[model samples]
Target: MPQIFFLSRPWDDRDVTWKFRRRPAPAEPDTLGGHVRVDSRTKNLTKRLSAGDVAVIDHEDIDRVSAEALVACQPAAVLNAAKSTSGRYPNMGPGILLDAGIPLIDDLGSQIMDLHEGDVVRVDESGAVHRGNDLIAEGEWQTDELNSAKMEEARSGISVQLSAFAHNTMSYLEREQDLILNSVGIPSVRTDFDDRQVLIVVRGYHYKDDLQSLRSYIRDYRPVLVGVDGGADAILELGMRPDVIVGDMDSVSDEALNSGAEVIVHAYRDGSAPGVKRVEELGVPYIVFPMTGTSEDAAMILADSKGAKLIVAVGTHSSLIEFLDKGREGMASTFLTRLKVGGRLIDAKGASQLYQSRISSWQLVALVLAGVLAMAAALTTTEVGQTALGLAQAWFLDIGNWFTNLFR
Candidate 1:
């Protein structure tokens, strides 16, 4: 109604929720009103958010990929039951929402979660939320200035985060050194990775675009496809089937499990798998993988240990801030899992850059045009073509003469 967009679209954060950070842009409108759609899981909320619906979410330190989803759904505004940026790290999601001209009401507390879905909600300029005639909740109005200030404060905490990251890395290394360094205890997988390139898909950052950029590479190489939970859906959306699906299965769809991918459930270090029951109920056979780190880490280790010639990863976290945005202090360095697979591992953006085609589209088009023109020129040099050209010239000349005679 109010210029309903009057906007503007990535899917899924299975691993390393890092995106390129941008400065916060100013909010376009101070006031917003719409029916509420509430979800505690931000990823789930994004799936159902429609244009003009005010998003009611309970996500703390909202990551960029989730913000992109909310913006894509064109929500009238966003009301958070938790702080958008918890000042643990300078997360890029809130800044992204503001940049898209969506109003953000922050830190309303868990009480705001009580707002009924489909209820008519109003977010006033002062950041007070009201349902009908009664005020339901109030929160901090997130603006460009506040976002910028909070980002600065969050940046200061990075030193502390880094120290914690170092400690976590050491602890993880001590616990999982054999698995990381020796590939011990990796279960037998049906999908062979030996001497083949592997593309491991995750749901963070600019995943869709980054994956799209590798379309040519995917076609040329036909790498072994592995999806981490919701990432399988991403591959499916791109019109390709995943060869293997890996994760806890919490966020993955039933449709993906049914899509015929070899399902591998990420299990606890003690070997208890959580998502096997869901997979079993769907009639999908699965194997369990026990690891001490993130699923993405397990994915890389699997690929590398099985002799994947090269591994390209989409939507993985690579920086300090990105690891912190993962909401775990120990996320830094992917617990040095990269070191184990460093010989073969490449991030999506890096892969896209390094895997460029030998000839560009413009060069190809120009070459084609040149060949056509040369063929036409060669044709004119032939006797038959010359005769045809003369006929054309005579016909035009006769028409010109006829017009001149009529004028006289």
Candidate 2:
């Protein structure tokens, strides 16, 4: 008989111990077990998560994208040092985790961030965090009911969010007017894009799908591939090498940095480039592009200034909610960057959907068949074909006469 065990909730003020008995296994919930993996940056944290491990993160108001990444990791449980849903916006992260059957401990306190990586921790039904026999932190366990209530409340505040987003956009425009109107501080890159298509990929929403869809375009045109930070890893995932990798260098993996791609570290107008240190540590050759916009924006400007005939952007945030989710105070530079690249710029989705392969396997086969049939018909219409047919008929007649004579 299988042994049965019941893992009680930590948030419950009850002392529960695991008892093993030889009998038919009971339908009891299993306790979460594994080394606790902690990171303040949720994006970086997701890269390290493995199945059955508990994730301790300090992300507040976790957005849908971050939540999806966490869910993909299939963690045993998630303990947030900050609120999972701050009611600031209708963030779908917490709800997604709950729906995926992953326990989410909401706002255990900032001290939870101090939990070293690989520390063994347990979470109970009531969402109490425990280290060995001592309870270290406690938080509310997010459930369907609570998440729904918070989402409803957040929905009601959309008007306020819109107003704030508009204000921020205007503020961004004011600060990044130069990036929008003219190319300024665009760095020289070894990769030439003169009269060629340039593909700028960011590890944003649906980037993988967009990249997959553009496989044919990539193969045919062989566009200059530019990856923004973690996007470099995405390019590598598809078995393609990046021509240039640009970003702050935090979320990108070391493997991508050493992939022989020309590294361009994006820096502020004040000449501070944090990613430069990582690049130096790796001893990879790199250049610094000091500009007043996001890495994605800088990539577009660089491609445009380099005389790229067309620019295709993948996973670049465009919607109001996407910008809000990015937690940027202003999108002014992005707006201006778009304007600067105006006619040349195209969204990945638009390009993929619009692009039709000039020739498909079936089409090629049909064309070959058509050519064969057309040649046969043309040959049959000529005197040579008639003479050949006559000769074939005479040969068959001679064969028939010979067989008849032999039988007789």
- Maximum-TM-score candidate: 1
lDDT of 1 by residue, 1-408 (tens): 122342322211233223332333334445669899999999999888998899999999998778878888888888999999999878888977876667789999898899988999887777888898888889998887899999899888878877888988998988888888888999999999999999999987777778989888999999999999998998999899999999999888998999999999999899888898899899999999988888888888899999999999998888766777778654643749887787677787534444557898999999999999987897699998888889989999999999999999
What's the true lDDT of residue 268 in model 2? 86
lDDT of each: 0.83, 0.79
Candidate 2 per-residue C-alpha lDDT over 302-363 given as tens digits, one digit per residue, 9 for 90 to 100: 89988999999998877655666666654545766787789999887434444557888999
Task: Give TM-scores for every candidate, taking all chains together and pairing residue i with residue i.
Answer: 0.82, 0.76
The lDDT, on a scale of 0 to 1, for candidate 2 is 0.79
Q: Clash number for model 1? A: 3
Residue range with the least summed lDDT across 10 consecutive positions in model 2:
11-20
